[model samples]
Target: MSYVDFSSDAFIAAFFLYCFAFLFYVVTIAGKKWSNRDPIKHEQRWSRISFVTSTLGLIAHLTFFFTRWIGSGQIPTSNMYEFITFLGMAIMIAFTIVYAIYRKPLLGMFALPLVVLVVAYASVFPQEVQPLIPALSSIWLKVHVTTAALGEAFFAVGFAAGLMYLLRVVDFKQTSKEAKRDQFWVEFSLYTIVLVIGFIAIVFIFRGAGYQATFTQENVTIDSKGVDHSSTDTAEYTLPPIVKPYNSTADHMDSFLGMDKPLFEAPSWMKGVNAGRKLNTVIWSVIAGSILYGLIRLLFRKRIGAVIHPLMGDIDPDDLDEISYRAIAIGFPVFTLGALIFAMIWANIAWGRFWGWDPKEVWALISWLYYSAYLHFRLSRGWQGKRSSWLAVIGFVVILFTLVGVNLVIAGLHSYAGV
Candidate 1:
């Protein structure tokens, strides 16, 4: 088979292996219920085997990247699909290192699920390997983007550790209001992560599917030369979408189903070729996410936290704090060099300016600043435990926004991420 096919197969293999490793970790945790011997050795024996399985998954994951690199003749870091996959690979690599040092089964369990989520999330983006855009054709693309992704991977793993800290340290025995609130928010956060995975899964499973409806009334407006124009017009709506053998101009469109154009007349302010369709997809994704989380809650008959937290009992909260701190401390300077310094270098080479206030640039700067402050607060202020873990969690959220949110929400020079 060709390298392209090999890479795709490897990617699929790696995902399943990771899933198996997760199941192994679950076995390790659940086996404690039946063990009549020493808890520590039993945990170690099972967890070590799970770790070995994860290592095999990591190897397959590495093969996926290497094969893609060989097939493409470039580092596959140019688009959302590639970048997110790269982030997943780095997370697994980082997790292995942390797991080696700490040797905690719960840590692997907490961290590996996110590795799977990220790899799964990458699949939601378009995966074709298009030729490089003019601006991205630089040696700096290899160095700058790669280092930045590695740094952010550390941040991602730190988020896992922080989450572990939160779950492990919480006093589930307390029936106080503050304890209840903590429990609720923790469950909500877990629900949100699962919801995102559900959204992507639904979108994929329903690919090329469409449903239709007719709109009774549509309020329309137009701005011509700063003059306001308004009208009430009727149009069709599609739940998924229905396509027709028709073409649409900016001014004229066929009111038909099973076509690319949204039959609905979008509001004048909503500018874009497919603004209505994008809006519809967002609505559908939310609905799908809700459905998935609701089913899990119904089956468990409790909040997700109540189900998962008990298994987290033997994990050390202090280790979670330390590992998170260590990841950030190692990752921060690397983030600074790649995201700030090398990015400016690339901007100068490509755009003929080093410091254009591009939206992506601004967000990258914001991410760097947040991590800097995080390091300062932890090291100088002697912050540790929940306070430090919270900051670690918050820092990764900022890094995530810099990586994904900026690309989706804003339009700028950096918007051409392998599209």
Candidate 2:
């Protein structure tokens, strides 16, 4: 089969392997009440199977990526869709490294599903071969994109660990068995609701901002003095200006239209709609995040102990913290090299200059800076435990903005991901 066909087949196999692994994990987590009286035996069996299946899936995933590279003759991250897939693979590799050191298979239970989700999302985009645009054909493309993605993967893992950590911190001893089961559902439900409401609110705010489009037109007219007057008509274009999700700017729009002199200019009022959309997205995200936190508290009746339980009897919070910190320590430098330095080099090569302040690039820099501060806060000032965990969470938030939010809400050159 051709490489493209082979890649597609590999994705299919990886999907099934991931699904099986996910099922095994679920069985292990919920097998306590099964016909087999020995939960420990079942857990052991399932964990073993999960590890094997996950490993197999990872292999297939890697093959798929490699085959695509061979087929395309370029780095995998030529588009937003490809970047998400790359991020998923990076996360899995990061998780594998963590697993190798700490032997924590449970983290895979959370992480594998995420990888599956990303891969599934990528499946929706067109997989056809497209030559790299002039801007993307550079060695920095690989280094910058890969490193940024690696950082995001690390941050993503950190987010999962943080959630797990938060759950461990909340005391669940006061609750009955049924309530304990309900606790997980409650937290997830609250999170989902906040996500939905916040999304709607953002849409409302942007719609309310009165987005407009401008068009430029050139007309030749004869004046009363019998002289020919060549005047450009700058009228607002009725159509909504096509603003990329991440790279919207007056300058970009001006440059985009430079080649096609205005038959008519778009209205001035519509020029800032893209910025309005971005502001709305940020506002909504904050609001949603706050509401989600509030709901978690409300669901537990304002008692911290009621919301979470300690780590599994065998695992210590300190150890979990250490594992998490170590992952960041290793992942951070790679992230810095790839996302910042390499990206800058690539941008310079592709765009004829180094820094454009594009939304994606800005967010990448922001993420890098945030993680740098995180490391400094932890190592220099000796911050640890809750403080360190919170920093990790914030660092991941910056990474999320760099990955998903930047593509979805901000208008920039990187907005091609159909976010």
Candidate 3:
């Protein structure tokens, strides 16, 4: 097999190892409640083993990344597959740094699964190494995208800590109505993760079973030079579309919806990269994930957070809250330099405009603004603990949306985003 093929295989192996390591982290946490031995020592033992295994996995994953780099004679940040995998690696690296300082097993328990999920999500995308377009051929492709992903990964850890803080401290049984309302938001965040996981799970099950469908769309646009382009004049396109938009009622043989053909068309301004198949996959995934989550809720006779919170082994909610803030504090400036500053530099070089209000750019700005507000609230208004924690959580959500959502659902200058 070619080196690229070997590297890809190695990548899959690393993903598997990360799954095992994540399970080990969970074992450490759960052992606290179930094991008869000194839970502290037991947790430490498993945590150590988990760290070593994850390190090995990181090594393997790195080897794959570098091998792909060598084989291609270019840095591997030019497509969705490369970018997402690298993003996972970045998150793992950031997690390692934090764990070294805090030695928090709960952190790993929360964070590692996200790393696994991200790697799994990356698998759904096409993995073939393709030649870069002129726009992506610059060295900035490596500098800008890699740095931004790394910053975003650190922000992901903030999300983890924020989540752990909520699970550790938030109490819904309070008699106050406000506390109950706050409780709903906390649970909603967990559901969001579940929804994404469900999306990923359904996609794999369907793909594994060789279930596929297609629809067609015709797009017309005026280029910068004022030249008109039309994909199809007729309502029906002869060639099959890879994905029909979510709002589409095209009335074709839609896979999950199983409709005859959609009767609707996407708006003229709602131009996309034909990433509707992904959207459809996500819809199926939500249905699948919801069923699984429902079954989980039924089996445990409690909410998902309630089930997992016990695995925390009574960690300090305050510490988790602080770590969440620290992560954002460190990550925000880095994110500004990479996602905003470097990205603008690259955009100016490629698109001839520093800021085009692209979806990706706009989301990055939103993340910055949200976190800025978070910092102000925390430091200025004395918002700490739950209030600040929620802001941290929301800030990272914006970051994730900017990282994944804009890249996939809202195609713009950065669509597919290796460029």
Best candidate, TM-score: 3
Ten contiguous residues minimizing lDDT sum, candidate 3: 233-242
The weakest ten consecutive residues by lDDT in model 1 span 242-251
Model 2, C-alpha of 229: deviation from truth (Å)? 16
- Please list all clashing residue pairs in model 1, or write none if there are none: 242-257, 242-258, 242-259, 243-257, 243-258, 243-259, 244-258, 244-259
Off by over 4 Å in 1: 36-38, 208-268
After aligning candidate 3 to the native by TM-score, how far in Å is the CA of 35 from where it should be?
2.0
Query: For every model in order, what is the number of clashing pairs?
Result: 8, 28, 15
Candidates by TM-score, descending order: 3, 1, 2
For model 2, how does the per-residue alpha-carbon lDDT over 241-273 read when each residue is reduced to its tens digit?
Answer: 332222222322332234322232224443333
- Per residue, candidate 3 scores C-alpha lDDT tens digits across 28-129 of 887778888998889889999999988888888898999999888888888888888999999988888888878888788888899998999888777888
Candidate 2 stretches with Cα past 4 Å from truth are: 32-41, 172-314, 416-419
lDDT of 3: 0.78
**lDDT for 229 (candidate 1):** 69
lDDT of 1 at 205: 68
Q: What lDDT score goes with residue 175 in model 2?
A: 72
Rank order (by lDDT, best first)? 3, 1, 2
Candidate 2 local lDDT, residue 393: 65
- Of the pair 2 and 3, which is ahead by lDDT? 3
